[model samples]
Target: MTVRLDHRRVGLDRESLAAAYPSASASGRVVVVVFLHGLVETERSWFHRPRPGKARNGTDFGSRLAEDLAGTPVYVRYNTGRRICDNGRELADLLAELVEGWPVPITEIVLIGHSMGGLVARSAVRQAGDHPTPGLSKVTRLVCLGSPHTGAPLERGVVRVAGILGMFAALAPVARLMALRSDGIKDLARGSLHQDHRAEYGRPVDAGLPAGVRQLFVVATLSRSEGSLWGPLIGDLVVAPSSAGDRTQTADLEWLGGLHHFDLLSHDAVYGVVAEWLRT
Candidate 1:
């Protein structure tokens, strides 16, 4: 798994970083917007044009951020099979290296993650606090889109079904198959952010957001009205609104209706909200 800058492969080395962003060093101060994809997803997932015929090139969230916000977007591609905590630690180290090797001075860093990627971002922030990563100091904002901050009911249900199947000798193999899901997927069941805070198929630990960093938790619902009965029941057809973020009164949360979980990846409305937040 490698990190990409504007869709081009970029290594952590100074030379690679310089080559990747030829004009970055000349910029007075750079704002790096990092994009992390969800489970079983690659960096390209963020740039996917669902309606290619209607969408032009460079219209994705990252590209739009580059144009609308004048921020550099870096996409991360990692193995989703690993545990969230493990990936989080690795991401922290990677960001540290990126900052250290960057051609220009980093004024701020904004992390935008979708689904499990959001959990990875939160975990990385926690790991950075424990390890004192250089990049963590520059991170000004952390955004999670349709992340299961509480817990993902779908994953929980899967584990329950697997448990029931395991009780039957004839269905044991099927249960084992279900159990083969990656540790990353298992982490989603409880939205585990840290190793110590993890539970065995239980409620998610309420690990608070990092201090001083502007946090935004975006929830997407397939229903027309988030206040409707089906809104909370079928949130984006994957994560419920309650699971995506705390429903309490807070300025950090935003809700976008009539969108699915995957739609959060590249939807124009999603990008609009993110861009406005970053601008502020």
Candidate 2:
């Protein structure tokens, strides 16, 4: 019943590029930073996707973040198809395994997630629980960029339609396959996401963020020109800024103006703030 999309497609370029410029395995001396993209986007979208005329969202965010954190080690996650919980669990497991098996010592782990990726990172931290991998405890900061902690109201109609259709899909095979995207969205709506369960998403500060984790929310505010008919009124046209703030009063939230949903990742202004946060 869990939907897992093909991430292998997004990572092909990265793999080939790595092969072309293979570096020594990062010794534990490296500061490990993981970048997670939003839904319906691939890893290639972070670095390769080019807009013929205008500056696209997220295009430069990853590159700039990596460049700014030049001395530190970083990994950008490519998967965008699975349910948020499934992705979070997988990422948590992968990080635990990677850190434990790494050839060198890992000094720190920083998680940076944009939009839905932010929700997944928070969920993954919860999944890490007390049985956390030894080195993972060193994770000092979690940054959520343009994430909808309170859920976006614009997708409400789509969510409703998906729920009705999802009920019928339970009776048919092809229907289930056809409803994958909707189901995934529904799961996000029902799970510990910003839009659906504000309490669950915000509970981390006291119940899940552990002792020393510095939680930061980087909200992107978009203008009316950025979205379509169903675009958000207050957000990056996708997620509203109101939904991006902390409900638990534990996180330090900062608003980054003039960014579209994707611009939060690519724009220099937004990137500057993120880079500064990572350094601190």
**In lDDT terms, which candidate is top?**
1
Runs in model 2 lying further than 4 Å from the true structure = 1-28, 48-67, 71-73, 76-79, 161-181, 190-207, 224-232
Model 2: lDDT to the true structure: 0.59
TM-score of 1: 0.92
lDDT of 2 by residue, 1-280 (tens): 1111223322223344244223315443566666777776644444533334234353465445445665333445545555666677677766765465544556777888878778777767755564575645767778888776656545554545555667764645544554556433544443353223433321323326667777788877755343434334557777766667655636877776656777665566666677787677
Write one digit per residue (lDDT tens) for candidate 1, span 117-168. 9889888887666687798878878999998887788998999999999999
Local distance difference test values of all predictions, in order: 0.82, 0.59
Residue 120 error for model 1, in Å? 0.5
